[model samples]
Target chain A: MDDLNLLRDLGRALDREPPATLVRQRSRLAQARPRRRRPGPLVIAAAALATAALVLVPALLRQSGKAPATHRPGTVKAVNLLLVGADGVRGDARADSIVLVHLPADRRRVTVVSLPRDVEAPAACPGATTGGRLSGTIPNRSLTCVTRNVEALTHVRVDHVAILAYAGLVEMVDAVGGVEVMLPRAVDDPASGLKLSAGRHLVRGRPALAYARARHGLGDGSDLDRVKRQQALMAALAKAAREKITNPVTLARLVNAVTSGMVADRALTPAFLKELATSLERTDPATARYKIAPVVPDPRDPARLVLDEKRAEALFRTLR
Target chain B: MTAPPAVPETASDADLIRRSHDDPEAFAALFDRYAPMLYRYVARRLGPDPAEDLVGDTFLAAFGRRDRYDLDRADARPWLFGIVTKLVARHHRDEAARYRALRRTPAGAVHDDPADAVAAAVTAAAVRPRLAGALEALPRRDRDVLLLVAWADLNYAETAEALGIPVGTVRSRLNRARRKVRAALGDTDPTREEA
Candidate 1:
């Protein structure tokens, strides 16, 4: 056949089987939504209120975390940050979720640590990990373990920690429309209703949040299982942010939503967030690698586990 | 005076870029118009299915980055061809795979008479594989300029406009791309070389 005929035939076949089949809502239609046409004064006041909320919320949350000594004099070199999330609403207690961030000394590599919830370790705080002092909450235990382990292993200092809640995660997901994920195994949990087939899926705001939190529904039913899920979801989120939504206006809206009710270490600022966005924009999804912290079965107790310090340290060192 | 038959609504490359920036559905119109021509060029060098996907993706990406449009240029062929050139290079294996797939299928009867069929097939057999390999091996810039002119039928000025390069650059690149293709095809005749 001639080249034109060959192309026509192939186009027909491809038309029969398109790569993407999802129904996407039109962007212009969304933009065309009704407006109240507020007066200039009211519009200005609303803008001011939104700006104040963005600045105050994160600042207030940062103050709640343990204030590490700011600005340790060193070659302004690569920094590793441990961002922890706690379940508790109060300010006095420790964090629950832990993400060990390793910024390469050359600023080329960024590795993250996701500590499992049930891994037993010596309580770092007077009663944080064991919840012996503060009602022994799960979030408290997780926070204590992360802080102690981070300080013990790597010479790289924990630059700052940000404690984000389920609400914060949901709002962020909603702001980004939804996040896409790949599940190696099926999830059939009644509680979360996270019935996913073994393949790719587009998890929307609420479902995506549930997927990150659902521990009991996955294979081998443990917090360890959930940690892996969280890392995969984070990678997928990064990919979607890079490929599907790279516009500044979309990013600013996302920042507004995520930073709306967030708590952070006083050290992380809006300037830092802007810088992070710029770095993130240049990066392609194919280059990023996400792995959970390695763990070994506890020698003392069969039911418990601990961080493989030697292996974990090696992993963190590479991040440097 | 009776109005002449209405010509179909067609936008210049600059107009298409502006429309693409404002409306994606309007941009899809450009894809539908040019994808066939683009696909045919690719299919001749590669095969069919790979060409289709590559052509679609080229238009999709071009549409997505419509804001980067150089509105001064009236034709988008060079930019579109540039994307196709990159994609084809990246998926060289896929093109080979397509050839293998084509080989397995029965060769359909050529449109000419029995005598011409044999001659045409004989010519195609000698020309097709060498052409494919040589086309694939050309430097990306030269290949882009050559195919945009030879297959997409772009003039030197239009090719330069599409590629965001000077007309002299287009002429030089086309010369280089043709010389390489000719060398691969084993055409040592002085007349063919001059052409």
Candidate 2:
């Protein structure tokens, strides 16, 4: 027999099941690892302080999504947050990126489901079936529309929503001294103003904005590919966020970036952000799952997106 | 919408390690994915009883050092097998004894060795008994390179990566090891490159 064939038989030599089982080791390990640590008194106090800081600046808290959120202490359950980055920070701008973060009851896993903005999600829209692309921006109450449509699709109750403009993306990236992203290939897309050589890049400000928005130049130019790149960038951002939490200057800058640029629900105050940052700091950056909401082309118009039922349900089941 | 509905892309093994870093419990999934294969590899060297505990320990060790994991390489098989190989080395007496038993036994069956299963299939495989002996006789590094490629089915590059040696070293060690094995079996292939 040739060397390769001999090796194949040799591999099969050890293929039989061992008399003992290693399956129980998983539970054994589960017991060893502690359950999620609850937010302690100091953490609570710090969160409260942070919340007070954000609340102190009432001018930043523009009531955009819905009526102000009535403050309440949260139980140890999953918190769903809707974070949208729009193209134009100040005016009525389309959503460039929409991500929903699901922090499990254990707060161990952070599942991020990114809604593709390029698709026409008509079913998500109240009346117009052709305009799901305008998901986070419709009429005066864009976040409500985005929240309502997301609820209809995933059955996930969004507890908090943060709408960030393009500038916010730049500020957040810069706040952490810039985020590093691994590019599979060099991107040179003038459409999204993304022009970088293929390699790891420390993106900040304008480049970061381009990195998030340069869907036109990267990865077959599909919205789905863009969703993946954004997820990687977000994971890097999350890693950076965890690292910066200990440094007061970066932490303050992060808080400032959120307060000044983001129009979030009243529930997403500085206290909430502090609690979240602390909770997520313990999380493994890799355990965070990124999913693009499943979509199929509309039969009548190819540009529109109709939620793919079976797959969409499967994606929601994990969060539910 | 012209796009496919949801293509649930499977997360790479490296990605799993990255996710497990923040959440210690996330390591369970990685254990579930790899423990069985690791157990087999361990069992082949040492018997099943020790294999069980070592497999568990390997995962625990892996979990402890997950933060140092390189996210660039998606397939973590080489890294994992490398860990298993080192753990197997600690049982040198057991491995040497198994090879001695195989050398003496007519059909090359060592207790719980899983060699008989392969021996039964290969025609006139009188050479396996000697092969086991030759493997046991080899230098640890040379044996590691050979078995990783021959038994573990890792390619040259993968073997190098797993062993933290250069590909040239992997080739040279494999050649030297193969020559010794061929000598033990008394199989003459003078034309084959032994470099």
Candidate 3:
């Protein structure tokens, strides 16, 4: 037999049919596609805060027909905005990251809490059973289901909901010329194609997204480590936003990028965002606290996590 | 306005890809069509364990770059193959190990199918080890060109498009690879009639 034909025969010998259908892959693809129909909220409440700090001031002033004025403390109420980084098409999307942004009644501090996606939580939605990973609730139920669960767990009301797709996250990061991330050790994660040496690096949109998404080949290979990275990325984004606010051109680009990237609840109107932004202006990036909800491995499934009741209550009480 | 006609089953890959730009769900049709063949091709190189994930990754990567696709090209096979090829390169070690393992496997060990005629099976079994050893010895690029043609059945033009190389380069690489394979098989020029 000719060598080419022999090679063909060898290929046939090695051929195998995949064990199962491509359902998992199909769903993954579905999740990766950016949702186009819904215009939701931005990824980082910090992005909104920064955008509001510079971009919205003039717009708000024009609407109110008032001279330049600062937002006084005690005028605005404490707000809890649920920022969800989700994947998949609308309605069936999965919440990969869930962060609660709390602005105190005094607006002196901004406390952003990262809730690990694998934590077990009760389902507060009607006709839904209790006890599943918080992230799973979004796919099985609606985004409202996830919000209700968060409220039930923390005893805090969710005033606004914003979902950011990965695509939007990329755009917002690039809009501000990229965010600086500090890695203690060099990372070369093949899965996500995130290659960065140890130390500080200013990563553009795609690499920033990869850094946030990569879990393996990093610390402990746990989901909590990824949560920490996400928090760090958000803080860096806020810092970048603060730095870029001085440049009107970059500020305009950021406003356009941030607004287009997110899908927000109707309640989170332009006026409301402006108010939130103005209130956050006094907040210092150094004083902004990032916390992960207290968690312990679930007794039933060690791989999953259950909130440590006492510590979680303490954490939630602080947010309240 | 009247509702647009449903996408026909016979819709070209480029048509589906264009539709997916507007409706992301439309990309699933492309997945359903090409995934099986793509899976088999990857499985042939990397074994079954990584095949499923790799194929899935290929489709996901393709979906992300769907807008950049040359809509003028009616067939997405070459494009899909190109994505899979790059992914396979990332796992080059696994592929080389697979080939080395095949070289060690005994003749007729894999071709034990009852449907195969005894004589043809013997011929295939004899050549399998030598072919695998030759493949393992070839440089990664030349092997890529050779396998895309011999295994994937992509013609010279399609192979060039898939690899992002010129047609002449594809010809030269394939020729060099075939010469090595023939030498590895001892140049017996066995008079077995071409299938």
Q: Which candidate is the best by DockQ?
A: 3
Per-residue lDDT of model 2, residues A70-159, tens digit only: 334344567787777764432355566788778776656678888877655435655332254635444432567777767776788888
RMSD of 1: 19.1
Ranking by TM-score: 3, 2, 1
What are the models' TM-scores?
0.43, 0.45, 0.60
lDDT of 1 by residue, A1-320 (tens): 33322222322222222212100112111122222221232222222121121232223223346442233334235555665554433324344456666544333345667766556545454434453221134443234345555565444577655555545556666666688877778876544536688788887866786687676557566767777777776666555544433455655665555554345554555555433323322223345457766788779776666778888777766765
TM accuracy, model 3: 0.60
Q: Using DockQ as the measure, name the better of candidate 2 and candidate 3.
A: 3
How many collisions per candidate? 7, 11, 7
Task: List the lowest-lDDT window of 10 residues for candidate 3 chain A.
Answer: A38-47
Strongest candidate by TM-score: 3
lDDT of 1 at A8: 27
Best by lDDT: 3
User: Interface RMSD of candidate 1?
Assistant: 12.9
Candidate 1 residue A300 C-alpha distance from true site, Å: 0.8
- Distance from true location, Cα of A86 in model 1, Å: 3.2
Clash list (residue pairs), candidate 3: A31-A88, A39-A263, A40-A262, A40-A263, A40-A264, A41-A263, A41-A264
Worst 10 contiguous positions by lDDT, candidate 1 chain A = A21-30
Local distance difference test, candidate 1: 0.54
Q: What TM-score applies to chain A of candidate 3?
A: 0.78
- Against the true structure, candidate 3 has what lDDT? 0.77
